[model samples]
Target: MKQYALLVLLTGLLSTTSQGQQALTREPPLVSPEIHDNHSVTFRLKAPTATTATMSGNWMRSEGFARPSATMQKGADGIWSYTTDVLSPEFYTYSFTVDGLRAIDPNNAHVIRDVANVSNALLIDGEFANLYKVNDVPHGSVSRRWYNSPGNTKRRRITIYTPSGYEMGKETYPVLYLMHGIGGDEEAWMGLGRASQILDNLIAQGKAKPMIVVMTNGNVSQDAAPGEGSDGYTKPSFMLPQTMDGKFEETFGDILTFVDNNYRTRKTKAGRAIAGLSMGGYHTAYISQNYPNTFDYMGLFSPALNNKPEDHPQSLAYQKLDLKLKKQMDNGYKLYWVAVGRDDVPILLAGIGDFRKKMDTIGMTYEFKETDGGHTWPNWRKYLTEFAQKIF
Candidate 1:
């Protein structure tokens, strides 16, 4: 009996030892924080007990390939952090998926108004990022006003960028309603997307036209993409009607109405246009297609229009014949441009082809840009430059 008991105890001890060894072999996922001083960026994680942690981000335009240790520091309740010397003015989308807990920076105070939106930090400067920059230029002054939606929804902020010559020149400049994707606001495109600077540079060199560009938030559209039901990036066609125009859409739409009412320019379809980046690009396409009379030109850069109305995400009857997607072939719009990197999202390559095929089948005229660089800003900036020149 004693011998049997001893054998059982030995077996239990061996099992315990093996489990401990396994625990030591496994590693906890690390997240190094990213930071930009002065409301631009900076990251901090409260982790007092952690031994080691690091961060990963694609901020360097490295073809969307994450560069580990973009910034990191340890200590402070296991809190690890990294910060950049006041960064150049721009809006950056990033998250600290620390230990597998994907989250936004809590220490940072600046926030982009997005619902269920991926959290990214923002840094504003006195130049293009600041409304004051518009005033500094020769022709027009940048203005921001609060726009109210129905249902007592809180008014939203809208930013407008008019050329240095807008007010003084007796010219009704064209309007480009540039938009930001999920996790962005009105300031993103003009600030980080550099809409004003791109236009300024282009106009200075005689490459772009002097136009009144409107930057707005496009998190929610009236006609939601099918896959958007999941509340993340997917084939929009996969989304259902019940999913379209959810709460998020309601909020963003308010911004759109505000822009139309306040901006001093042509409000007709030909004078107004819309464009966006990433999710913003997708929004531009979706909204322009659905609201054919609103915009004369449409620009989509690195657009995540993965699913057309009927391709992969055929969740609705409209997906079959896409009576809802007739906007994809709207002839009333003047210009439509779709640009994406070769390796942006190989998964979406098939979707892009299908979307183009549908457009071709409809005999729609549009520009398709396949540029170098992955899902980073090089292609996006370039796309904006070209799109501006053509639209303006």
Candidate 2:
């Protein structure tokens, strides 16, 4: 009798749920960010009750980190729409402000999370942006693997991209240690930077060699990215503990050991390269110099080279910078490529200048490339594409 009663209750609940779901209003299907032949794009949103609407995107001119916004027009049919001038070929992200509230395009399925904020992704294919797309080529395998970090006393996560045919072949490949910025995690390069797509396209076009790309979380305090760690769904922050304190660089050996043991790697400095953006750039500088013979190629993309206080615990890492450069030079390396945008902040420009002056004093031979934009993912992606082609 009790079982029958429970079954009747379950049936009633399921019927109510089905009726409620059926009664819910359904939104009309709409196409958004419609790209035209001339590269002009039209964006549409259905906000019938909204008083005001605006569109903001990375493609627009940016003052520092602020992107310019465009006012959207509301039609008599209650749809908000905006059209942009011919845009350059690049991957861009955008969001809409409807009635003063920030919202992503409901029709766009492709979205990326930048720290805490999520925005819709749009790719205008052509020129350099072609490298960012997933082309018709043999693809690579990207995996999220966990390794024990003895220095940090925790199990850490890493994102590794193995080139195509890695599993079927017995050949060993070179390795690239790619690092992210202050607020990013291991997924940053693969997601926002599109490192795998860049590599696959470059390798398919015979512009780059097929290798293993290892992306590590530079934050020593966290074992993994926000929700992926023991701390569940913690909000991400630009200011995190031990990001630039040199502990992450100190504990990088754990990642190296984990990769070498698991994957079929070249296992030599000649077959290794390291590159990073922003805070990761600072890390690349320190890690490559501190372990002078570990990496043969180094790329610093908009690296933060500011000096820390003398009383800091890891102040020694910042101290004797010239001696470390000399040691790295003496040990010999294939490439030391430095790139920074002209529009980056004055402090970063000055920091890069000071670091370059030190390198000049030590007579270190390196390649430097100045781009047109500021500290952004576009610059970093471009640097990675160029750097990957140049390395083993």
Candidate 3:
């Protein structure tokens, strides 16, 4: 009986030793999406059971690839990896497909919501992309301020960016009202456009003046973005309703009044600037036209100038758009800038062309810029970087 007990103990000790040896043989999980000095990136995934793995990312095109997805090779240990060629410096979104299911990189923590989909974000650092990267510089403060919007009859939120030293000093800064496109709220510019980072890097490099950037919700109906303040209820669409016609223009004064009252700002037209993307572009054009002399600098980014007579149907406000534009010219504004991506949608390009024709007829002077790419965030961010340098 003693011998039998000794044999059982020996067997148990041998099993424990073997398990320890196996644990030591196993490799550690890699730091995925490892960025190299050469701008090439390697993505890794440890899926012991996945038979096939593939990587799909926006970087494919940037890397001179025809397709976005690249097949990853599985090693003997079941770790899958793929290294891409040198890519341009910018933020890129990517995901992995294991078998047939698409999933974000398990090792990557940076993620962003682009429209309805979520993916991992990889920042390739270089050149203009460096502007989007947060560096060790004097940073600014961003806040979501809730205020009463009598225009929509609800409390709305505006994302405001006050530059570094705003709290320490008693100086008033110029105000730039930067707005987002449709399907976006006040958070769009900061999140997707990386406006704060752009401004921070620019200010640090003495490229842009230190100023206050205010991002407002352009949607006329909703007080804020769905899930912002209204109990997290998501709506179906972001398009403006016909019922809210002419409400935005009438109630825009509320936003101005609130900002001027609460923040330390220069109260003159020279100290004010308004700029926007897509639908926000339409808003900038409309506001600048409707309220001439309100802002000295106006940036229309991919402006969707809806000047069709059939759409507005001789509405006095619509008919007066040209007149308001003329008044802006007569009032002697500092900068009237219009920019659009060369590959923008046909509808927007057409409207821009029509507006340019009108401006030509009225002899209104403005700076026109043609950027590369379509209606994309990259283009908008580039526009913001360029526009900021030109403004106060």
Candidate 4:
């Protein structure tokens, strides 16, 4: 009787499999976000009865996730489809809203997280994005490294990227401490920015030097980013407490020491680079200033500037920062790069202008660039591509 029952179960499983195959033959699978050779993308959804459908993404002319960039047209087959004009090569996140409900792309499985927003990913391979894409080049290895943070009250997780030849070679490499903005964690660069792939392609193409890139969770109070660790300290808040209060610098030296001791690092200031985006830019500004002799290369991508009167050059805070900047300049450094998008927030633009004026007044030489986009990942990734090539 048991054998008969088992046979019945196996027959049911095979029958179900056959039915699924038959259904597939009757209805073809929908191919969404199909990219053409010209970089145009076509998106489709199998919503036969939906009254309306719209698509929104970061690649749209307007920023943020609230606005719909394209409208979908219903076809005779009850499928809604929309095709975009020729787009540049880059990674983009978008979603479809059927009627009044926003939903992820059912056809595309590659999704990306931006703070609290989750959207389906679209990749159009071209110049820089090709660098971001996984080409035939030798790739690097990335791993999560947990270390005790003396500054924070918990152990922190950092994402480390080792170049392709790192495992077999005995040579020491330079270290670039990469950072993300507010609401981001150690995985931000690797996830949204595609840092590891960019570096791998750059190194393979002889565009960037072989270096170990360390991405740290800039949130001081949190041990790691959301859902990244077993610890219960992964909550992210809008207040940005640790960074605003200057707590990130307190235990930064410990992280540096750990990296130097554990990894095959150059063990010198000249071989170190520190850079970040937005809030991370704020940290970079202070970290490079507080520890002038630590990093020989400093990059600020859309750096958050304190534009208050009290933060001006004549103010106490500005005076101290000025002194450190002078010290770093005198000690000799490889590069001091500040880049921002032309369409960035007006206040940020004002801040960057003020900072540039101060640097000019102090006779502090540095490079400044204003790119095409606003305060978004596209600009940040472009900045990294350029900055990494310029650094040692």
Predicted candidate 3 versus true structure: per-residue lDDT over 46-151, tens digit per residue:
9989999998887554321133589999999889999999888887778899998989998898887654456898788888999999999999999999888875
- TM values, all candidates: 0.58, 0.92, 0.84, 0.90
Question: Between prediction 1 and prediction 4, which has the larger lDDT?
Answer: 4
Q: Which has the greatest lDDT?
A: 2
Clashing pairs in 4: none
Candidate 2's C-alpha runs over 4 A off are: 1-28, 307-316
For candidate 2, lDDT tens digit of each residue in 22-70? 7785556788989999999999999899999999998887888778899
Model 4, global lDDT:
0.84
Which residue pairs in model 2 clash with each other? Answer: none
Q: How far in Å is the alpha carbon of 4 misplaced in model 2?
A: 20
lDDT of 2 at 354: 87
Sort all candidates by lDDT, best to worst. 2, 4, 3, 1
**Which ten residues in a row are the worst by lDDT in model 4?**
309-318
User: Least accurate stretch of 10 residues (summed lDDT) in model 3?
Assistant: 59-68
Each model's Cα RMSD: 15.7, 3.6, 6.6, 3.2
Worst 10 residues of 2 by lDDT: 307-316
